[model samples]
Target: MSKQPIYLAFSTQKGGAGKTALTVLVASYLHYVKGYDVAVIDCDYPQHSIAEMRDRDLKLALEDDHYKRMAYEQFTRLDKKAYPVIESSTEKAIDDADRITEQADFDIVFFDLPGTVNNPSVIKALTNMDYIFAPISADRLVLESTLRYMVVINDVIKKTGVTTIKGTYMVWNMVDGREKSELYGVYEQVIAELGFEVVKTFIPNSLRFRRELTETHKGVFRSTLFPPERSQLKGSNIDALADEILELIKLNGNG
Candidate 1:
């Protein structure tokens, strides 16, 4: 029997912080590379980006020789099928995740939630998650928005002792070498003072993050069906992020 699925979300009230991309990339890494049974509940309705990506991935794998061969070789090597990405509304996301997990033994179920907390269902869905990874960028507006959002999540909901959330983490995204390291340190210190822990792995800015598996592309970096190419993962810090998340999960007795 598999353990109860650990619910997680890469969330923040701020848009353009790479929540969907991180959700897909990290879920793929954990499922395909780290030998975990994973699924995703795409509750970002109207957009349903991850579910749409899955659709595009299927098409690409069918019509594109490069993707088809890559998919075939990867599936054969891993002896595992692609993880499920369920499109659902925020109100039904938890129930939908339960139904899917009941059908298959999944170690983790990642949720791609809406970018705003104004909706009651969004708050409900977030409260049910076992872990929340909020992405923050170096920009002033982004940081301020993330901080205010985290205050609601950390102080208002989680601290009230009414949620399943075990740990809420802040992840630094879009980190660039051109930026001063001190800027990050100062932000980290502020976040720490607010009693939030930031993940040690900082995801560097890279064009590969925006790339997808296409007919002409030689390597696949992000897909619902396959793990990213090792070369594409180079300098992305995804592996380290996965490791740190797993470590935190283990520490919380959920891994």
Candidate 2:
């Protein structure tokens, strides 16, 4: 771990942009695959998708053999322990994230924020983030919303005056191979000008990503159902994404 109590969030003003899915992906990777302490705050207000997903996962993990074996293998790889993931609202997520880190000795905390910034509570929650990642598709509407969201996060950085976000990254999701259209390059150029990074490890356009994940609560990518190593996702895949994230933490210097 670069430093303790690191806080990062997955956010975008657009719904269904893979915030919760990627949140689980990264958190599970850190905890099970890399053997670091991690937790997640599902602060998506009305939806609380993370919490609901956890419940569904528990159901299937108990009933399904593959999920049960996956959980068993993860614990066996580690020391037979579980990481903590809590659901909180904006008003309490910041404090709770810190409290859990301190008390539980968590290396990183992930926040799965709501899809809209219209809520003031949600806006306030960004002040606690040390880094923020936004997953975006190649669609025009999503790009527009993502651009507006980046501006809002930049504004929050200035307004807070406390280095709320050390870096902002846009994750290219559902990408149709590296052979993107001209539109994709243009968006990357614009985002680079805004001082944000486009993560190199892109998730390929695959129904595997769209697979209903309730059956594998221990993880989606790390689970045996969709092994990252053999899957057609990308190099390092989620594992590489996790490594890049750790490198990012080194760049942030205790953020």
Candidate 3:
């Protein structure tokens, strides 16, 4: 039987839309909670953000005894062996992905794509993915770029006949709930008109995210790390968001 792997691509034609952050969160969640043997392909050449984060996490893990123990425990529970993120692009990255799927025995592969649509390598990477998650902010430029990315991917799907595009998801990241922003409403309407599925969960603009990056810990987002000064995202909200994403994968049965 062929091993079916979940291929998720975090993509957009705009930078600074929390692509890398979302990628890390998803992979970390899968590795720690879902117990998936995950591999990451850092296809964002010239600036491999995913690779950097992984390296940082590794270094932190090595220095911190508690983190090391946690990582070791997670690996022991995984059905498949652990593999590090592969950093490559162009012909080489494509070749590596094929090899990794065949040999490494991963259950899922996350591709951290660059924020530009024109790169041939990026298009090739997208063609291989089961789903594309496009993170969008309330900024006009980012919204325009996200739409452009969707169009580009749609074109590629039509051309390559890769039916795994599934659909595009617009996640509201770095949102502030206290303030009402007109740009948020405008972007939502635009996305609705464009026929994209907007994810209901909004990742609040919190310092916890930055702390996660520095601490290099997994599942911090899963728990309420602090009170008052660091308000945790509602448990129901996180659970619903996770369920929606998982349901997308289950419904398609492609990822």
Instruction: Please report, in order, the local distance difference test score of every candidate based on alpha carbons.
Output: 0.89, 0.72, 0.65
Residue pairs with backbone overlap in model 2: 236-240
- Model 3 residue runs over 4 Å out of place are 73-83, 159-163, 178-186, 213-239, 251-255
Please provide, for model 1 over 1-255, each residue's C-alpha lDDT reduced to its tens digit, 9 standing for 90 to 100: 356888999999898999999999999998898888899999898999999999999998899888788889989999989999999999999999999988888888999999888889998998999999999999999999999999999887888888999989999998988343988999888999988899888898888898888767856788899888899988888888988998887732343
lDDT string for model 2 (97-174, tens) is: 877766756678889887777777777788778888888899989988998888877785545686566778889887
How far in Å is the alpha carbon of 49 misplaced in model 2? 1.4
Q: Candidate 2 or 3, higher TM-score?
A: 2
TM-score of 1: 0.95
For the record, the alpha-carbon RMSD of candidate 1 to the native fold, in angstroms, is 1.9
Model 3, 1-255: lDDT tens digits are 167677887778777787776676666655555555667788787888767766766776678786678567756665444445889875466577778888756667778777766676666667777888888777777777788778777765645686566666778777776453787777788778877778777666765555452354434452111111113434313334555777777732333
lDDT (C-alpha) at residue 69 in model 2: 86
Candidate 1 at 166: error in angstroms? Answer: 0.4
Ranking of models by lDDT? 1, 2, 3
What TM-score does each of the candidates earn?
0.95, 0.84, 0.80
Output the lDDT of residue 207, model 2: 58
Top TM-score: which candidate number? 1
lDDT of 2 at 111: 90
